[model samples]
Target chain A: MSVSVRKTYKLYVGGKFPRSESGRVFQPAGNEAVNVARGSRKDLRDAIGAARKGLATWSGSAAYLRGQILYRIAEMLASRRDGMVQELRLGGLTPAAAQKELDNAIALTIWYAGLCDKALSLLGSQNAVQGPFFNFSTIEPTGVIGVIAPDKPALVGTLALLLPLLVGGNSVVALVSSHAPFAGLALGEVLAASDVPAGAVNLLSGHRDELAKEFAKHRDIDGLLVSGPPDAELTEAAADNVKRVRFCNLSSAAWSKVERLRSLSWVEPFVETKTLWHPVAP
Target chain B: MSGSLSPTEFRVPPVDAVALEARTADLATRSIKKDAKVQGLKLAIAMMDLTTLEGMDSPGKVRQLCQKAVAPLPARTDIPSCAAVCVYPDLVKIAAQAVAGSGVRVASVATGFPSGRTDRRTKLREVELAVRAGASEIDMVIDRGAFLSGRYGAVYDEVCAVKEACGDAHLKVILETGELKTYDNVRRASRIAILGGADFIKTSTGKVSPASTRPVALLMLETVRDHYLETGKMVGVKAAGGIRSAKDALRYLVLVAETCGDAWLSPEWFRFGASSLLNDVLMQLEKQRTGRYQRGTDFSTD
Candidate 1:
């Protein structure tokens, strides 16, 4: 007789999977043995800390390296297809719905993985200025970004918003859907398997309302991305740090409209333009 | 002259390692938030020994450090100046000159600091040099080689010699507790340093791993508290090295206030030997005022 190894989904912080520091856990589907870490504000704080530090290397590294790492994440996601689909199904999706969700998530990852190195050249500009001055503008990562992923299309919604941020070298701290946290928590496992640097992608499973305010208000978070409906309170809290706040449409139908969801605009919101002026001596 | 009373004269009580750790861990859970947090953080800044002990530290760098020590938050005038700016013997003059008339003392780490591997004559000379350079505080390391080899008297005499060499400067004896190996050793070293005229008993040299851990700081604090209770002498405790966060610094404050009462909360009685800790404290203070977490980029690197 073989005994299956049950999984205790935990928070992915700074590239390591740790049980909640508070030692709290909850069942998403009420499975007897399966428990997801109920992450706290402290966990979010730790994740943000890691993301801030990770932004230096994530953004500093050559674009080619980031693309290759994202490609690795895609490969890891494909390899872990069975587990992801299982998690999606566990979150009340039909088997076919779960498979489609997993497929869309992987496709989004692969799409952004290929576009990582091209973001700068596509968005940047070299300006023709007055004599003795050569001025040029380049696109830079928006630094640490906080993601509030939607409840519906849990896996796809997360990947749709998260993958684009990484393509531009933005380190992310994501608070996944509270209703269907299983798939998102499982994605942490896939991210861990990939060569994704610690802190580059931290995934926490908890209530969106509870963490959304803290995520938006965090001064270290340079940008805030919210999926589903716009939250006025979240937007107001984000003003405390003057964060670049962007809301995304992560509906099931929107996921099918690939052109809108997979465009440069998705990546544009999380990048800042840095223009530099240098003297050209004759 | 200070070593007349041998450290061995008093049988040093062995520390309860498990209990000590449990107590520190319990004390760390104290919820110091809101107004208490802002107040505690500013107090931490005030108790800070803004240190830059790198081999590459230049005169300009020391001057800049002194500048930061004097005005931690230049935009706001509410923040108090740091307790002192801790540097090496060579840079003491620049640091002293920069912090002069600013109420920020200049402390120099001397006597083969981080490693007490030099002779008595040379060690005392380094202390003398720093004092002559206008440093009001002298941080000297204890000879672990002597202390480990059961030469307590020699170590005691060395601290006394360095203390006398300090002249008017307060002598802070660094135990380099990471090298001490055990709680019993730390307790014994604390007693020896205090008896040998240590105005302060510091934890580590920043060169060693396991520098200034909570339990170690608590043990050292306990020794100081015991000494104060018995002899009515209030020797300061500077938990140097490895104390790089505002939260950890505040816990040291909590440890002091709990073990020795509120008397040790002031900069004169307690200090934190740290460099990066200052920015973290400033960030926290800003977070308190602005109601948002802070960014390291917003603050000055020094």
Candidate 2:
């Protein structure tokens, strides 16, 4: 691959970044000629398809690999802070606030990177019962995750939620903020630049609620990470297929990486509780 | 004048053939055909039984526990919020303020709860005071002497008076079934409360001998089913006392679902009068939908 080939870095669907089938484009960076691809219904369908395929592989991936990949992504993100800061400025953040936003983004990445391994350490334990057999339980990754990024820190909050689950070996299908698609595409470009697997992160940017209902209702999507107000309708819709719902109150004054992980912890539904019982052969 | 129901006034259901025939017919029509599923499992959770939580050395700690008890339920894929939080008449204000604007209702046990020994006028006054103090619901205990001694009229009249005194506030008439002594008394008391205009009939004040039991709950739900048929009002039912877990809440939901059908599924009609139970239900729901165990202290509404 040529270094300057400009990979177009379109919506990642089915392990590939393809231009939106809609042919619709928006000026995410507000620069002429360089239009950001707007995702379409087909792209969402393809994402659901990709998530269905990657769910088994990602969930079965070793937790150590998950943690290493996550840490690597955080390191890559740290190296690209200037580029992210510039993108934030272009997306309407003030210089001072952008600096703070950049800090929060980096902090969030590092924080979640550290948590990548600890989640299993904290959630798993050995159980001692009266039965003759040794009982062990470990927290497992939920299947595919659907994320609706926060509208304000579009990239940072998205990455905050995305990294934790991804590090825990969960594939994600993200519908990013409508107003801040540039930072999302930029991050996607960065993920592509890094060695993050093609199907590991599928990022779609565009429209406030274009695919939210579908995302919530998608049968293949096991868990939903929502970083906004509790949408009762969407929540009730998720109930159609019993999707695990994790809603983050972006309006709350207090939010941190721990809160993001705790919110995203709802992904445990896809974890299969395997009980090993060996009967004595008579 | 208020001690016990006169012996002459006590009416017994037919032990003879003619009365037995009518009873059997009534049982067949009601139990087998229409309301066949009415079975009760206790669901009410009494808030702090504290007549004075302020007297405790650590009111702040108690207050924190109470707040923890009333924490917002975690999102659940199945079932719904069980019941309103029941507090003392004094703490009704705190509870109302604590859960202000929250979907959970504030219920204060009033009208001489548990004993119901206060005068009728004072009882009505207690009801009025609680409602004015911001209690969305009131759980008033019935006078067991009048109920047991077969002074049905007096028992019925007192409940009606308390319900009227409640004004717009929903009145939950606690039968103190533990003191009522038998399933028959529990059934009759439930009937009397419903006939007397109870919006919801609860099990006990959690201050009696055997607060709330499955058998008692079953009898009451049966009465509620009959009452609903006789009068189309469709009053709510609450099984208070000893309910303190998510599984407990679900059992109550199963009871309500089995007995009252899906209409009573809303928190409006069915409630678990629990203090520590809400958190468990929330944790279970969180675990069921999210797969993590969150302690009651860890999740806070305020």
Candidate 3:
């Protein structure tokens, strides 16, 4: 079966895939029509706008609905597993490891779906107090997360990491791996088709160095999930915005427990424990 | 978000060696004597590892030693409460009660005490237990093994996790300097710890023989002072282990005064973790004026 692919791969800004604000498009290796360039300040602002808009409803959404949306994305990705493998291989995954890549992708989705409920379960609390006031602690979403997905796991763990942050009701501005732009573009397609609420996930694929720096210093990006060892420049830039950075150190070959933290890294990036104190009343 | 990047904003500034020397001179001439039963002296900061107390002396004996050290200061003038009293995980409560209402804070070394080779959950648990036991400050040693092994993410994550475990208490990260030999390694460790949410970047636990040198203290303080310049957050610095005299504390204080500034010299930003050193500072003050050694009992351990 021959697939008639589109001539252009637009930038995923807000909820829809659109051409770059600069109207620029560049091609990565092995791709016909995908642009990997610098996203404009306007594109960043729009994603931030979408994130601010979506934060309430997404976080307010029931965990079941969040899990349902995530599980559905995984199912859809699984359904198109062969195409994903091809995309991964195109991005440099060996043909032998393509099946394992698909499995990892599927498992990542499910694992994150499970964690949506687990996060609240493990981190939340109801205090049995000495007073008549009702006090409880819930795992609140840290605003918009800035994600730099791993170049190696462009299809699976990267998307896996992104899904949990979104499902946890946090929006994200992702700098998809430049090396694996196709896989990121494909994942963006699946997210857009699902009920991910548009700006919840924005995929900016172009110059990895440029996008990573932008996300690092962008005040709009509340936290960062650096999917690999960020260079000193990137690390220093992220520090500029006081963006909470989660350095995801997944090697090019193996995916380990470290992968699990990438999801949490993004989710809790902007989290600050606000200890509210009130005088004990009569 | 990828693009060509500019230079980092978190670079350390040049040390004011001249200004530091001047402060040392000023400290030498100042008459720090007081009229009260317990006289307050401005000695260099001492940082204790708490775990080493096992070989030093008994708890009662240590308490007596602390009382004697503080005895020369004026009764109610508040001589900046012996920097801080550091102890093991279980002794935070005892230390807290011991130093209660005395302006002295009780710090407990947690996160596996000597080494940080544990799970996040376990590390956090150590912090939680220490905090719950009345530790006003927590000194957690970083996993140097993980850090040296190039596990930067794990190190960063663990430090943040331990910080969270501290609740309202301050967190002091100990970079066992004897282990992290080079100045560059010490600098990197200090920056990483401060960036990852440490309240203080300390040098050494004093387990090794050569603990808490001036250069290592200089390196950690330089990083902390730079962090303050960048973000405007005042992270404290503590020099621990083998700091046994007022002169030793003075040298570290001189370094802080030079490396950071006069603003950081207050007890809030400076600490000395010595068990037997406070008395020496008091003794020095007494010797400066009176030329005779007072009997140990003449100084009240009240």
Best by TM-score: 1
- How far residue B191's Cα lies from its native spot in candidate 2, in Å, is 91
CAPRI accuracy category, model 1:
high
lDDT of 1 by residue, A49-70 (tens): 9998888878888899888988
Standalone chain B TM-score for every prediction: 0.97, 0.74, 0.79
lDDT score, candidate 1? 0.88
- Deviation in Å, model 3, residue A134 alpha carbon: 4.8
Error of 3 at A119 (Å): 1.9
How does model 2 score on DockQ?
A: 0.01
Residue A112 in model 2: shift from native, Å?
A: 2.4
Ranking by lDDT: 1, 3, 2
Query: Which segments of candidate 1 are over 4 A away from where they belong?
Result: A2-8, A21-35, A125-136, A229-232, A275-282, B1-7
* Predicted structure 1: clash tally: 0
TM-score, A chain, model 1: 0.94
Report how far residue B171 has shifted in candidate 2, in Å.
83
Residue B82 in model 1: lDDT: 93
Best candidate, DockQ-wise?
1
- Winner on TM-score between 1 and 3 is 1
Across residues B1-302, which tens digit of lDDT does each residue of candidate 3 receive? Answer: 11122213223344455554455565545433344222224434223222324544466754653453343355534333465667777666666676667666677888876766777688888889889988888999989988777566666777877888788999989889889766667777787788778888888777765788766677677788778897899888887777776556666666777779988877678776665565566555554444332223334442
Candidate 2: stretches off by over 4 Å: A1-9, A28-34, A255-273, A277-282, B1-302
lDDT of 3 by residue, A94-141 (tens): 887777877777777877777776676555666677766666666667
Q: Which stretches of candidate 3 lie over 4 Å from their true place?
A: A1-6, A30-38, A128-134, A230-232, A239-241, A256-282, B1-302
